[model samples]
Target: MRGLNDKVTLITGAAGGIGRSLVRRFLEEGARVVALDLDAAGLADLETQCAGHAGLLRTMPLDITDHAAVQKTVQAVHAEFGRVDVLVNNAGWDVAKPFVETTPELWDKLIAINLKGPLSLQHAVVPLMLAGEGGKIVNIASDAGRVGSSGESVYAACKGGIIAFSKTLAREAARGNVRVNVVCPGPTDTALLRSFTGDGEFGQKIYDGLKRAIPLKRLGQPEDIPGAVAFLASDDADFITGQVISVSGGLTMHG
Candidate 1:
């Protein structure tokens, strides 16, 4: 939490369940936050929900898959704030289905939103960090990426790519004092998670099985995620980079 006071933090998917928690956590840590989401209405709602911290928050509707738009937004943010101290790549989308049941179109969409979107943000923000006071990047990946998931083959692939990407970027940016890390959440109780239940019996089965298998006996809550994310984004983590931390409650453990 140290060195975060008045720091500019940019979070994508800022309107979703976990995203909202991330925004609130940063704001509470005294960080100036820019909340980006394609859901304008959700962003507006987020602003209302964080009314007490209104002065510290700014909401922007962004489609991260749009390279030009991403560049423009990053430039605009830098122009106004002079620097971006933290970046949280929390935007992602997925569907629960067997790999063979998925189509090429689905694959493209998954890749673009989950992988390319974060890369675009990195491309735009890393340069600024390199040129100015360095920054921290916390990417939200999934346990599905570390171990595999039965029905999320493509999504898992994208997240695995994120883990690899973050590690490589951290190595490249360390000289500039830029830190990049990943937070992999296990099954979290979020709108996205609920959506899977509606997909069919397979989805429901996966959800139920996850709850039973988790050593903690319950799905993760959105609020459970921020402490880890905020820590990784703060001066306390200055010595940490290129590492992946799982937020899941014993659902998946790795050395």
Candidate 2:
């Protein structure tokens, strides 16, 4: 879209399933992107994949939960690109265990990666956005947060927290010309999902079950997420903020 043309966008968790899709989509839209991920190898792969795109892509291997590192990276982005016009906080980790089985440490890790990571990134970027004209922020939440999923208690809690955080941030940032929103994605065919299932048989069963539950009778793809993200990040969504739009296949309709 014209909204994203020539813009500088930063995507956290850029090496993951949906994250990589977002990087590719944004690049195709003519946006220069800074792709950040904890996996150095994945980041390298992304760099290789986008090699021909040249000036359109920059990869950063980062742990988003590290506040100092996030700040440093963000500052570097500003120095390099002059401004960050759009930010997609898409990096997250999940622990699929019952609430009783979840240790305090495990809980903390989930909260740190899912909630605190976004908080830290926002703190680092919002001031720069204020100094600039305006900016867009799209947080990748989950349907689990909207409708609780079994074996993902803490993960759901963190995602729910992100939704709330985005709403409040939207209100606070609006006056500064900054727009914030949330995109809740359904079960997608991602490496993370396969990990949750553990093996071929179990993974197939899980996918089948999810497909049955979804009204569309199919699972989402990584490609399904980025279009919504790109929309929210674009000027097309300038008037839309504090909204939680689900990208599920009519799995949970809250209205």
Which candidate has the top score in lDDT?
Answer: 1
lDDT of 1: 0.96
lDDT of 2 by residue, 1-255 (tens): 658998999999999989989999999999999999999999999999888787899998889889999999999999998998999999998967889998999988999999999999999999999988989999999999999999999999999999999999999989989999999998988888877877888767877898999999988999999999999998888899999999999998995
Candidate 1 residue lDDT tens string, 80-189: 99999999999999998999999999999999999999999999999999999899999999999999888899999999999999999999999999999999999999
Per-candidate TM equals: 0.97, 0.98
Clashes of each: 0, 0
Q: Hey, what RMSD does candidate 1 come out at?
A: 1.3
> For each candidate, C-alpha RMSD in Å?
1.3, 1.0
